[model samples]
Target: MKEYASILSKDGLKIATFSNHFRSEKGVMIITHGMGEHSMRYKEMADFYTNEGYTVISFDIRGHGLSEGKRGHTPGYEFLMDDIERVYAQVRADYPSLPIFLFGHSMGGNLVLNFLLRKPNNIRGAIVTGAYLKLGFEPPKWKIILAKLSSSIWPTLSQPTELELDALSRNKEVIRKYENDELVHDRITSAFFVNVHFAGQYAIDHANEIKSPLLVMHGMEDRLTSPTGSQDFASNSGDNVHLKMWNGLYHELHNEPEKQEIFNYEIEWMNKLLN
Candidate 1:
């Protein structure tokens, strides 16, 4: 069953969140959707966890999906962090005795990883998929320099990230749904891009600060976010981090044919952690 709720962010943005309950509950998982998508996109993934006796919770971030805010805009990185913190607090309060885990993808993964670095809380662990540590392709040097220069003057100025949708998934239905999804857009504010770019690199540099056991997964063939970044982070993130590289898989591993295998791996990982 999917239930919805709304909460006010520190900066007064009303964020939208959802909870999907399983018939039998073992624990709760909080999912974070990637850029240009909403909480609903994770229905299948959440349901998979639900069937495994886990309740799932996820939110549309301040500027995305059904959430209230300017599309693709943010006040600052600090503002975004506070919004995530508010969601974490609410979920933690609701499930006081249940173990909590986090799952974030792409841009959401970047924020979730940084959230740990900012403050390593009492959460059990995390799973990051196709995290945006470094872009598989970078924006032009001049454009990035200019965006940084003008960001303060015009915080909401839109810039296209030039993400290749074709590189997202091998499944036709998944790609089509994403392309036709009205909520999906490639334009993000100059300020948002600058903040995201800096934060992605910062998360890697401070990987050791991550206090939770982490499972980091990326596709070796991922042309969106550089897989090497994930590899490098896993290599140096001490013994607590486990890295998985899916050969020839696209950015959306959940949509791939081998998704069940990955899901089984997640089930095993989380179950062991819970035990």
Candidate 2:
């Protein structure tokens, strides 16, 4: 079953959500999407999980998709965490008795890791892909200085992300679709950019504090976010955390040609954890 709804955020913003339910679900997967994208983008992955007897829940973060907030802008990092907490609480209340796992990609991956470290939760495990721990390339020194300066005064000032579209996936069709999608944006605010950049490092520095099992995956050839970040994170994290580097794939592993194999691996890992 597929359902759509909206939930009010803590400060009274409407957050759009989507869910795919299975009759006898074995578990629940809560997905958080990356910057400039919405929850609906994960339809294929959600369907795969539902077929595997798991219900899936995903929400557009406050600033993206059908949710309310300035596009690509948020007041601060705490608001982002509160949005995740709201969705998580709803899932826990609705599904009271199923194993819950969190999955995040790109910026969403960064947020999930930070959330796990800073917030108290009972999730069974988390899966992170292409987390923006470090950018594949550094920004111009002047641009960095400008962003820092503006972040304090006009934090919500939006700027184009200027990402290379081709770096997202090896599948040409995926890039084509992403390029054409109206909901897919390229805006990022100074505050959003600076805060997440630092938050990524914070998650890495405190990786050892994470108590739940973590599966950190990144594409070795990813030009969007550095795989070394994933490498460093898994190494610093506890033994329960594991890392997988996909060779030749770009940033979006779930959208790559070998996505099925990747999905199977994730399901297998989750099953092992559940057992």
Candidate 3:
């Protein structure tokens, strides 16, 4: 079922929160979305999980969606963490005893991995797709230095993400919808760039710190986030971390042609953890 709420973020921002709950829920999931996108794109995934008897909750990361903040901008990383924490707290209070899992895509995956280090011991497991632990492609070092400096002087300065939309998925219809989506935009702020860059590094440094059952999946062809990073994390991380790689898929696994196949794997992973 679709439900909505106004979440008061710790930094006093009004966040637009959305939830999809199944009648006979076996567990709950809190999803964090990628940068430059809102929470609405995950409605299909949320519905799928709900139908599978899981309640999924998510919010627009501060500046991106119906949330109250500057577009494509944030105060810092801690502020972003607080926004996710608010929804996490809400789910815990309401569900109380239900098993909870954390799910993330791209930038959201980076956030989920970071939170795992904080050791939210109550969570059952986590699922990450195309997470931004390391960029599949590298930007010029000069450009990176410029953006970092711009973040300090003009934190709200926005620039095109230059994301290759074609790399998202092979589904023509989904690509068409994404291209024409009003809420979807290419602008990303300097502050967001710096924060996520640092957050990505932090996730790698503390990969072994993740205690919860972890499943990290990435499309082998994803040009945004490196699949090798996911592989390395799973290889070096504690025994709980597992990695799944899709042969020909791109970054947006949920939007891919074989999404159901991928979903089946995710469900199986969750079920094992739930058991």
Pick by lDDT: which candidate is best? 2
Q: Report how far residue 211 has shifted in candidate 3, in Å.
A: 0.6
| lDDT tens readout by residue for model 1, 1-275 | 28988999887779998988453457888898887778888888898999898989999987788898878888799888888888889888888888889998998899899988896478898999999888888778997799888788898998766678889888888889988998776778988988988899899988987879999999899999999889878866888899999999989777787889989999899999988
Q: After superposition, how far is residue 8 of candidate 3 from its true place, in Å?
A: 1.2
Which candidate comes out best when scored by TM-score? 2
Reference-based TM-score of each model: 0.96, 0.97, 0.96
lDDT of each: 0.86, 0.91, 0.85
Where model 3 places Cα greater than 4 Å from the true spot, the runs are 21-24, 119-121
Worst 10 residues of 1 by lDDT: 19-28
- The global Cα lDDT (0 to 1) of model 1 is 0.86
lDDT for each residue of candidate 2 in 214-249, tens digit (9 for 90 to 100): 999999999989999999998888998989999899
Those runs of model 2 whose alpha carbons end farther than 4 Å from true positions after fitting are 140-142
What is candidate 3's local distance difference test score?
A: 0.85
